[model samples]
Target: MTGFHYKGGLRIATLLCFFFILDQPAYADGVRPGYQVVSRAEIIEAMRQCDDYDPTATTNGARFQGEMILYLAQKARARDPQGLPLFIGYENWFQAFMEVTARAEDAMPQYAQLSYQYKQNTEIDYRIDRVIREIVEAPTPELAVNVRIWWEYQPGKPDRYSYMDTLSTPNLKVTNQRVMTYRLLDFGNWVAYDEIKGLTGRPTSGILGFLFRIIGEGHILQTRMAISKDGLQFNRATAKKGFIKRIDTVTVYPDGKMEKDIPPDRPDLLEIAKRITQPLEIDYAELSGEK
Candidate 1:
């Protein structure tokens, strides 16, 4: 039920700078270069203290978390010029858990008595919730975050898949294209081969062909995300359905330079997607050998 997510852009003018920005780091025993790690609670608490934030707000939790992530990067960079902002998908995890809740609410028919299990789920959800810190060392300061939504391996069940597609320019104009920067991972439970075979009346012996596997055995399945951006709008869509979207009601560039970035109207896990990608349009442009 675990996966890795890395989102970066290019057109770097010099391989040296690109390598300097990325390749210099060497990993050993869980230590990451350019920054240090802090527990998710520390980040979350710090965010609450970031401003006169109202806890009663609809996305109070996420707003604070997002602010903390931003301020921490701004602070860490000031202290360590070479630091990059590395945010682990802690909020992503929370949103996914919320989706579980949403699912239960919708499918009450199949999961009536299992309501007691929901409480236990929340505790585990928080414990695993986390956001790792990293420093931004790009030649030009960039902003972007990676989204990793993959299929959880489910024992005896088929692995779910997902991808994304872009919105038209007009649609992008209205929504501001922020939803385009993430992947739509499915953590949902899927039908097992046994369950399908029961209805299909198919043979299950020896995989029918005698020695092969039809489905993976595990609990979760997911797919990776691809990203694209235009002005304050971005898309993290695949070629089709089964994707997660984070649309912006207002519009602004990620770097805050354009002043057109949009605040999301829907902040729910399935709806609102935070700016996971840091402000990097400028940095990426510099890398592109452009002025």
Candidate 2:
């Protein structure tokens, strides 16, 4: 887990500028009516204030603050529907912040237990815990609108991974849009088997081990999925620079029928892909909170 460090002077300056904007009559409502753009500075300030509100300061303080932030964000979004971008940004930040905090606390006990059991130098890296750094609209066809959520691992870490999740829909103004596409880009880490074998033993030494030896330690994995009126399509790819490259795709019809184009030689890989693609029936409408 990474600690949150504050730069007081920089934050103060940003807040001062935000207050100046808020004081102007034209921007009295916390929005620039002409451009229909919410003040980024003010958004930043609100996020900072949320971060500064320590829920653990007193009994149940954290829960209270969390609820308050959620309420305020919901109200803000309703008050200025045109400021959806700003509200969404704040919501993403707050969600990530809470996730990181919870994961950090959870990891402590798990690490201790693992260390005791192994009697070796062991550390738990909450690999999936990330902070949503930014959210921006992505360019897409005129019929659809899209947004990307950028997330990063622990700040300032040398091996930190940065990635983005994209969500797009054909109809942005409606809640009944069933067709959607979700993409997860740059989400996996690559490391050689020899590097971490000491920590994680060679569980198997058959064909899998041989294949690993041929390829380098680290391999990147990426996946994309499309959900439409017809059905769902999922594609997964794995690659090791100049070594291994393969892609497998699967399609599921609305009638609960599935088809695949996996190579017969790699049934193991096909099985893995099937497992990964299983249970991917996420609700896009619920996820986007459009309704």
Candidate 3:
């Protein structure tokens, strides 16, 4: 829930450049033809402001605190298919955390009410929120990447995940993709929720569109993604600019193989592999030589 703003003064030069060339095809929407590859130092410097980016602090203060409490409550309540508690390895610590929450509630009355509601609704619709961050540096040092992924359950609304990166040049922050998803059943499967109108790839045609449908039926790997440098967009468009977002999908097989809709040569997708997919421990043989 972090408010979308970089820490430095707006680069008037970049803004002027954007205004002078806003109508360019690269600046507008749709698949970008290509991207400029920058040195490791440049990538790092572009994303310097993002080192302090905090996703948890963007929303109202109470919501995140409430979200934490609810998340813990759901974890404590999770059950396996056999109707057993899912806290196999960390049961004791999880219970201790619950007890601490109880103590907190004793210290604060409102905490008790929130905790009770969250725990009670474990059987009903609930949300499980998680965030993961990683940095990947290739051996050639061609890319120094910082990736932040947001994959979370949003009960009552269309569940979705987002990928953001700090590799966009000059401004290292941009959201490459955000896709909607939904629970298939209680058996732990989710499909892309794209049947609704107004989504990026509508009419559900073409390879990418078909890929979205296939991914809908597959076991969602639940991973998150990129930033654009030139003509890049911000989460908060102060100067009428936003992140250069693309709606793309991928399929993860049972054996851990991945097939993405993006053509292999796209630089954004290459960065996605290095910055996000590699960290998940899925082997990308093409990037096998990368560190």
In candidate 1 the C-alpha lDDT for residue 213 amounts to 23
Instruction: Enumerate residue pairs that collide in model 3.
Output: 1-58, 2-58, 163-225, 164-225, 166-172, 169-229, 233-242, 233-243, 234-242, 234-243
lDDT of 1 at 63: 27
Tell me the lDDT of model 3 at 168: 17
Error of 2 at 201 (Å): 19
Q: Which of the two, 2 or 3, has more lDDT?
A: 2
RMSD values for the candidates in order, in angstroms, are 18.5, 19.3, 22.4
Judged by whole-model lDDT over C-alpha atoms, candidate 2 comes out at 0.26
Which lDDT values do the candidates have, in the order given? 0.23, 0.26, 0.22
TM-score of each model, paired residue for residue: 0.27, 0.25, 0.20
Best by TM-score: 1
Candidate 1 to native Cα RMSD, angstroms: 18.5
Q: Rank the models by TM-score, top first.
A: 1, 2, 3
Off by over 4 Å in 3: 1-203, 207-219, 231-273, 281-291
Error of 1 at 203 (Å): 43
In model 3, what is the error at residue 70, expressed in angstroms? 17
